[model samples]
Target: MTDRTYIDIHVLHSVPPSNLNRDDAGSPKQAVYGGVRRARVSSQAWKRATRVAFTDELHLPAEQLGTRTKRISSLLARRIAARTGLDDVAAARLGTALLAQDLNIKAGKKETETAYLLFFGINQLDAIIDLIAERAEELAALADDALTKAVADLPVREQLTSGHPIDVALFGRMVADITSLNVDAATQVAHAISTHPVEIEFDYYTAVDDQKTAEEDAGAAMIGTVEFTSATLYRFATLGVHQLTANLGGDTNAALDATRAFLTAFVRSMPTGHQNTFAHRTLPSLVSFVVRDDQPVNLVSAFEKPVRSRNSGIAEESARRLAKELSRAASSWGVTPLAVASVYEPNSDQNTDTLAAFGVPHSLDEAIASVLQAVRGRLQEPA
Candidate 1:
């Protein structure tokens, strides 16, 4: 087995009548899995939700996160102007030149727009500004041709890779124009799908103008139908600890902190697709984390056969199935996890016996702390 380490997280959550993720027609997103229609939430949506949680709930430093945008020129221009004491016009011009030379990106019709959207962290932006200010005198003296050449020669890739943001390091970056700047994602999130077969249900209703009383207007002002579904969803995500460490330039502490933050945020965050219409804010009924030295395992196969709800409900059945599958996999594959932790909603009918059989923690706080410690212990070990 390889020495590389990995963290796998599994979650079982149930949402009420709500359209958490929708398609183009404003219907809940779905897919045919295991020969049955299953409600689906794209990985992108959950990832965004987790990122938002990082900011809103965890209160992580904004500078340690990355931003995705096509208007990178404008973002950099404002930073350049603030740092270099240059006017907006001059700073913007310099920012455009620096990006064009370094990233090989052509500005679009709009001065702020780039050829494609770019993902960058604050650290990278600061490095670019510093480089510009360092050679301000030289740049001021050079002609257009010489200035372009000098800017191109600057170590743009090196700067971007250093002091990388936690989110950027985890999610990764891809600069089509500059392949060398690309950072492979250290995390993987699977599309959350209902454990049981799902059928879309529509709610039809009408709106009467508030200003028009019953006597003023007998007819309704508007009418529409909203699609929704309620199901127990299976959400899985994995973090490649070795890759995360590499992405953060071998900073294991930062990787551990990120892992902890992600664990809490992912469990608490809820997608707001139709929150105004259907306020279905719910937490995971079950949460599990396994730190392994082998490979990342996704136990979604447990749900391949649709789960039938009993008196305990679908969420309880889903949790039991997951725990059983995980146990079986470990026994058959000779898998040995460094640490394992789990949490179950106290009031739920779900049985915690299966997870307890694996020596998993019952408290969420204990579980998170255990996983973080395990990661730190592994990193400190000599190869």
Candidate 2:
């Protein structure tokens, strides 16, 4: 069966549907993009909030979530053992040991933990007891023969020395697998570049305006656009059905099941702004997965920034460059899905020319709504 699995995510500064020129806070009263100033936000603030949300939900590293072995194993073990006959001590021992062995902790001070884990994972004690009970009749028959002797032959660590390492790779341990990461990024990007954008009401002087006249008058009033930094990102990851199967103890079926489950859970749980986490508003419709890096594709990450130049539209051009790099990265990893990141500055010029000086070009104000749609269309088409 075809994997038919890929993700398309975008992040931006803010979104406002209409108007031109922002106030002192760097938000758009309105500006021009896609040949018109629809509304605007900044990319940096969106990414920051979204990143924080993800870290909190997954207990991920302060910087990145969804890729650490310890975090995944510990989380998975607890989930698997829940309401099962297993106790906490047994479960922890199983999880920690399995993770240690999977990471290839051969010999060291940590070997104690590793050995303990291996024993629990294989359930040696239970297996030995069961075997002894089942073979009682055979042993009783052999007792009449003086030449026969009984000896227990329990396997030591040497028994598996010649065999390949135990499989311990669990899925859903990275941002890629956490579908919300992509969804949130896409949602943030949409918010950054929308036609009518939402702004946070942090000013104490501002009163709630529910009246029709107040609403009408609010159009020209200055407001704060959500701010955040967005970088051109390029990401690649591979799911080695073969290596994965070996890692899961040669159970191809189990590997496939786990992969499917992980992918589904990740996508379903993706987080976004104040609302839903996995907002599909800016998500691309079609996705493509290549066997290697270098395929011609249009989606990328938001981490990498391009070299600056004197060009006026360098930000969008940088996005194009990032798309190209994304294609290359996917081609480099056999059967992996990779994304590219394009830097975007949603608001007007700021005190620091960080993004502008770095060479990321700005977009026409209306470009936000269409960017994800355009990228999705490109990926959905056949090669």
TM-score for all models, in order of appearance: 0.93, 0.29
Per-residue lDDT over 1-383 for candidate 1, one digit per residue giving the tens place of the 0 to 100 score: 12488889899999999999899999999999899999999999999999899999899988888888888889888988888777787777777778777567766777569777788897789988888896665564566787777788777667776788888888888887688878999899999999999999999989988898666867889999999999889999999888888888777788788778888888889889999999999888888888998898899999999998767678877877888888877888878677888887544443557555346447888898988878887674223
Query: Each model's C-alpha lDDT?
Result: 0.83, 0.32
Residue 353, model 1, lDDT: 76
Question: Top model by lDDT, which number?
Answer: 1
Q: In model 1, state the lDDT of residue 222.
A: 99
Per-candidate total of colliding backbone pairs: 0, 74
lDDT of 2: 0.32
Top candidate by TM-score: 1
